[model samples]
Target: MPITEVFKEEMGIGGVLGLLWFQRSWPKYSCQFIEMCLMVTADHGPAVSGAHNTIISARAGKDLVSSLSSGLLTFGDWFGGALDAAAKMFSKAFDSGIISMEFVNKMKKEGKLIMGIGHRVKSINNPDMRVEILKDCQTAFPRHLAARLFTGSGEDHHFKEAKSYPECERFHWRRICGHA
Candidate 1:
């Protein structure tokens, strides 16, 4: 089937974003919730590794696409790649019938750092406002299993104060579980 037809058949009318809109039978507020997530994670600043690399490449006379590619290349495990790793971990645990708390405790027992758990600067006292906004969005989907699991785990470990790692994990889980 044509891509447009497939989208129309699956989502009624909208495109990719429209498909996301219909996922989980979410209400209209889901769009705003997703937009908020995008905005918050859009950019940390020019000082961030990705932006800094892009800027350096541009100043070094690289073309726009090359510069952008150079910046994107810098996003590896330590930079912006933790989301994938965390999602895999969450999925594996869930699939293996391990509860969220048990998974967290297993990681802790192994002396493993939770990928999306902490921030270098932000802490319980100096919380990230973006995280707060996303947490508020959770109120709209109180019965979401992944949301509840991640939120509870994050709060138990104090990661909720630093970042929206739980929400990120929930998003990945939903996608992997075919709910997205």
Candidate 2:
């Protein structure tokens, strides 16, 4: 592959990956944020299924690419994509003016569990160190839905709307149903 000037070898991995993902050279702060994410998740995640799959593939004598692909293919709603679903829900609730407590209660009433609220292994007492480390830097990188609504540039485009939920206009049905 021809290496363009924008994605030169001299640039950090985060900057190169960010350019590929976001299609632009992110600011220094954004690159740092991505690097922090990479650092936190760079360790061997023994508990997650993806890591397990990768290990199994390597043990079975699969090549590096195959092993990595095996792990990446395991990502879905339960694991790697949980945050994505949460972002959508957060954006929907914010746009609809549905308070966070109300949104949680409504989801409960409908028998739908909230994504990214809990973990398969980690709990309140036994928290993931990576998550704790990231949480410690939350002030530097405010990713709350309300924060995104105000700072249009900082937000990821995927968090702009909820695919599962219709537009806010259809929210009237929810109000009607609550009264029933």
The reply for model 2, stretches above 4 Å from the true place, is 1-10, 45-128, 142-180
Worst 10 residues of 2 by lDDT: 164-173
For candidate 1, the lDDT comes to: 0.65
lDDT of 1 by residue, 1-180 (tens): 356665555533223454554443333454455566667876565336877899899999999999999988888765777766778888889999999899989998997767666864577888888877777776654334444455654233343455555565567446543676
Give each model a TM-score: 0.32, 0.34
Q: Which is the leading candidate under TM-score?
A: 2
Our tally of clashes for model 2 stands at: 0
Computed on alpha carbons, the lDDT of every model, listed in order, comes to 0.65, 0.65
TM-score (C-alpha) between model 1 and the true structure: 0.32
User: Model 2: per-residue lDDT, tens digit, 1-180?
Assistant: 236775555557766775566555555655676788878976645547788899899999999999999998888764577777888888998999989899999999997768778864576778789977776655454344332344455444443364312222123222322321
